[model samples]
Target: MRPTILRNIAASVGLLILIAVGYVCFWPVPVEPVSWQAFVPPGYVGPHAANTRLSNINLIEIGDEFGPEHIAIGKDGRLYAAMTSGDILSMDLDGTDQTIFANTGGRVLGFDFDASGRMIAADAMKGLLAIDPDGKVTVLADRVSADDPISYANSVVVTLNGMVYFTQSSTRFDPRKWGGTLDAGILDIIEQSATGRVLAYDPATGNTEVVARGFSFANGLALGSDQQNLFVNETGRYRIWRVDASARNIDVQASSSQARVLLDNVPGYPDNLLRGFDGRIWVGLFRPRNPAADSLSEWPFLRKILLRLPRSLLPTGKPYGHVFAINEDGDVLDDLQDPSGLYPETTGATETADRLFIHSLHARRIGWVPY
Candidate 1:
């Protein structure tokens, strides 16, 4: 009787193991991961060498608000920050006189001021929005057609000629339905669908048209000093692209003189691109590359299996804070890093004559360091 009972217990444990294996192997996941070779991460070396330069940043408290994702100095000489609560807050450079400028009722990832001083916002859930000086909000473009709507509007740049260019991050995973911006982005990147796009909106005719497509996750937009070239961040693939501003409906994947990768195989996941002082474009490395993710990149089935695990087991961005400035030639000019990662997600920096205001995705206060 004792022998029989021990055998039954062993059998039960074996059955449980089989069930777990089957679930991990066959369970459906949202991402249909594509097989691609991930470049071996260039560890902190050369221009991107490790440093403690960003360790001593000062904070600009925003009271109860958090996640000051994108910031810009408005034409009125005040700093405008788009918070996670959908409130656009205006404050003095010293973090004083903070006031709610406008609320778009959607998560705004990036925004820029137009020639008319209206804030053009790339709201992740609400599409392209324009907020007037008096705080009236308007939806400029939400859909390309009745059937195709903009899923993730991100990073906007208003040219001097009144053309508003913005990035639509992923067509497959909507942030609203898939938790939020960061989660949706993870799904899209893991899937490698390259559904991201660049679009142009003409306020004159209320018409929006596609500029370029075929980015894994098209983020961050900045116009060249000539106003003829647009610098775009393709986040998932760890690169930046320089696309001709006039190129219409161009596929970045196909060989085209219209779009070319300017920076390739950077050490980390690049986020926003801000054109800063003296022809330097500032870029933030949101997270360092995960070797496990890279190793699975060429194995689509394994990637799917990996996603079947618990959400907590999935690889996420580390807290390491890093941001850098680059020239048009793709040379790293300044690299600031906080290995301790005390400042959270440093998206990029807004450079004034004297300070570099660091942006973050989850920090309660805006960080700054002397320029």
Candidate 2:
């Protein structure tokens, strides 16, 4: 073969191989089998009679040194928090000097612990990330829409098989535009596409599947104590939906299986959810969907037109902080409001021995709130 011809042939072969590998690496691998449910709970007014308010609430302002999003309290009585700006920090019960434990170079949101005590985070800009005590970072679920680089990791919880059930708060919004679209409320969903769902991330096989879909804005995720179903909080719809992770091997029929809502309108929009040792679910609230926002949500056709404009030209809404205490049955028990109103609403919660730690994405801090 001529020298130039040989070189051209070699280059063509390399390009073909690259294209093949790229296709496999970046494909929307559909859900293996989905459990589907279309039931939504009736709009709730307030806490049910069976649920009671949590008292003796105490707050600790862990300054800008350690900004937090979601919180996790390990077995060692130490609290770990995912910071929105770029790092995860550890703090003591008395709001002591917080220390940076993990630096993922992305906004950290939801997190949970594995059997081995490794810290897993639902990073907003990045996908799922795991951090060991030494601060080693690992990418568990690197992308939601793998081929598209569509990432919006939110809240995460671990199962026995080291699998993770998590949420991607909004598919229409990514970290690049988070600051511009963070609190769009119901209007965003009405204006944009409804792209929210719960996902199953298997570490052993390095696989991620969308187990449930059709949510307004999926935010928090948690497994029932019995492990019967994985619950996801759809912020825009103002409800929580349950998915049957066990049915993945069975069937993917429309009516065969369903992801049902546990509770809706717990007096405020639920941001992140956690099941406590006592059977109650601790949820972080970004804020109640401003009724005005909800009213505006009904006009998506018009809002959709506005979103196409430059972000700087849009009217960004205000931000605030809120928390909710709900029981195992999905009933709101008490409302945790920000009396000080210094920082924006919270994302996750952690319980340290006698204290409760919270992550404030809008405020730069990491610390505890008296339970």
Candidate 3:
């Protein structure tokens, strides 16, 4: 009996030794480098002309009124905004007629208008929803699969056939878990896993499919005006990718996919991407470049510590507040910033025929511009 017990113990000890040896030999990912280095790794870009303008703009404080996330403009010149705090709002360009458009009591992240002028929103807690003029809300689709659970539904773009394209920001983390605390370099590393994906929803058929995957941090989706392709903002990798939506072959191996790097490096990390009314692509940028951000996230031990820290205690990127307008190719075209410390930190943006609207999650106000 004693010999039998010793034999079992010996086998367990052997298995433990093998596992330790295997881990040491097989598990070696590159450690986090030294700083927010460049656009690619520890990838930090050198500063260029700040194409950002803090002026041609003014802020609209919605402090206690609403917590706006993304904006959509209607043909009637009314600005529709998704309130992440559980409501939808419509504001006149003048900022006078602010009213509750819908009360879903859920966080609406990205929003767009369809051909029938219905509001299509990507709600974080709820999946995709359609909002009517009377503020009525209907659930279009809800994702329950662990692979695509619509955690941080960041951006939405509607197609002519009533198809909706949007992003589920990150697979490793969600905004509610990492938003306020995503320090410089650590956030970029979380994105390196490239678990982010772009998804499409067809209301006519209630079908949703993963269109594009392997994005560093997929956030925005926009269909080119010519409808030839769609551009997506891979924020973590600091670039935008265009994919073929109308491709014919779909044998998985024969699936048609085309991707181009419109913009590769930037002074600050880019967020949402929307087709501006004035023939340009407007991008929301968060956190300017910093080297320390790299060292803070490079090592696995340090990264685990950083991710566990209370998000509020984490460091925020410099140039804490601003918005940017770039071309579809990712070239900086216009800068919208507030030099003063008035507006909230900007998150998402949308444009109407006459005005450009920007929303911030941590700030008390949204900003607008006369195009």
C-alpha local distance difference test of each model: 0.92, 0.64, 0.65
User: For residues 130-164, could you state the per-residue lDDT of candidate 2 as single tens digits?
Assistant: 88878899887766554834367778889876778
Question: What CA root-mean-square deviation does each model show from the true structure?
Answer: 1.1, 13.6, 8.6
- Which pairs clash in the backbone of model 2? 36-257, 36-258, 36-259, 37-258, 37-259, 320-345, 321-345
| Candidate 1, run of 10 with poorest lDDT | 310-319
TM-score of each: 0.98, 0.75, 0.77
Clash-forming residue pairs, model 1: none
Worst window of 10 by summed lDDT in candidate 3: 247-256
Cα lDDT tens digits, model 3, 1-371, are 69999999999999999986666545543333222323333322222343345554577766575556677677567877766567777888777788888877667767888888888887766677888888899987667354646665667888887778877665565545554223322464443566667777878778787777766667777788876677887776566777776632122212344656677666556676777765787777665545444445444455444444565544445554566776665666776655442555566577776667776655556777776
Backbone clashes, candidate 2: 7
The best-first sequence of candidates by TM-score reads: 1, 3, 2
When 1 and 2 are scored with lDDT, the better candidate is: 1
Which one wins by TM-score: 1 or 2?
A: 1
Clashes of each: 0, 7, 14
Overall local distance difference test of candidate 2: 0.64
Candidate 2 stretches with Cα past 4 Å from truth are 1-45, 48-63, 144-150, 177-192, 247-256, 305-321
